[model samples]
Target: MSKKPVKKQDPETTGHSWDGIEEFNNPLPRWWLWTLYACIIWGIGYSIAYPAWPLINGATRGVLGYSTRAEVAEDIAYFKAANADLREELVAADLSEVANNPELLHFANANGRAVFATWCSQCHGSGAAGAVGFPNLLDNDWLWGGEIEEINETVTVGVRNETNDDARYSEMPAFGDILEEEEIAQVTEFVLSLSDDDVDQTMALAGATVFADNCAACHGEEGLGDKSQGAPNLADAIWLYGGDRETIMQTVTNSRFGVMPAWNARLSESDIRAVAIYVHGLGGGE
Candidate 1:
């Protein structure tokens, strides 16, 4: 066999050891060094092109002078242009006229339906069947009024709020303070009897006396609610508060007041009209 020589190791790190292991200093990879340099150059270019510098008044206007708000406005303008005819048709047509015109009605209803879902659906249900304190928009019985113009007014100016100047306002006094429990019970029975013909005639007769004295001034002798007073007709099955005996008792004890929010500030005129039309189309269009 021929003899072979062993290669010698470098001596600068010969004495350095970590549990008998030695370390070597290596230069960074060429690709990594270039990548770092490229990042620094890209940052400088980006800062120059965009509004990166902050001043006392605002940010600097870059060479492009582009703005996010301007871009948004341009986008909105484009969308409006594309849908101009539909918007115009809705704006020009009276809500009742729109209902008669199938195409315009469709356009208005679609937009109005969407807005109602966003704003009004929370109080008035998705189906427009209102809750305990809210009147059902789907029903013909209207407290404030159900005409398209009236609905539009309600939409523009909400009820019982300082912000709404012409807000619908009415209040029924709490009879609990004035009337005895027996008297309240009699009134509750009377209110229910107005709807049900099958009610106990004897009890109803007795309740009628109480109704004549306490309720006839607001709710007519026939139980036809006074719109001017915002008193709902007791003869109808549609109860704003509720129809149950317990709920009716509660209403008689302590009157209820419902509120509808103003959509004028939150929505455009066209949008408010659209919702009124859609709600009218829901079956309460008067």
Candidate 2:
């Protein structure tokens, strides 16, 4: 039997070539071209119908007059109007009495958690455990007083922040240039001895005198710390930074200044009260 002749087919190429390799001048599929053209038209229409161009002040409010911010504002206004009575009640009610009202308490806690997550969770952990330099809210140890009123005040005015004139203010003098190296060491040793039994006995003994002379005003003679001045109790072993000897020395040498913004500037009174109530109920409240 004789085999049939084979047919050969070749596509045209563009006049472009690289290293003797010809470029195929293939037309895009008809469906793809139509889709591309449709998209280009849709894009142009969308640009005219919505915000697309950027200006120095803001983006253009396109023909459709659509604004995401305006929508959000409307939604917020609706919610605020709906909850106005409850929020007013929350603001008016005493902090201690907030828990007694079931409806008020529920509203406050839910709102408070949201507020805390948005504002407080940045420094304090999601669980309010706190980070280094930040105070842990879950523990009974408090840099300032942990009472609901105190928490309200602290949240309202903030701590060590220059923005609020009435901010909870305290400054621990950096003892690096103030104290002699040996005195610093002795004081650090004494600070350690307040929490730990195992320390250099001689250094600790000398440190007691040094502590009395220098740190006793804020830290107390017994090293129990003064809450009025935001001084931490050294005897409790609860450290804002770390309890290590070197860390303590560094802290004494260069004092720590933690700043919290006055929430009153950003949040309403009701929101602040809600937050105070939420924090108080977090098991660390006095």
Model 1 segments more than 4 A misplaced: 1-76, 84-89, 197-200
lDDT of each: 0.82, 0.92
Count of backbone collisions in candidate 1: 0
Question: RMSD of model 2, in Å?
Answer: 1.9
The TM-score between candidate 1 and the true structure equals 0.70
lDDT digits (tens) for residues 119-177 of candidate 2: 99999999999989988998888777999999999999999898999999899999998
Candidate 1 backbone collisions, by pair: none
Report the alpha-carbon TM-score of model 2 versus the true structure. 0.93
Off by over 4 Å in 2: 1-6
Candidate 1 lDDT over residue span 94-146, tens digit each: 66667678877887888889988999889889999888777689877987789
Strongest candidate by lDDT: 2
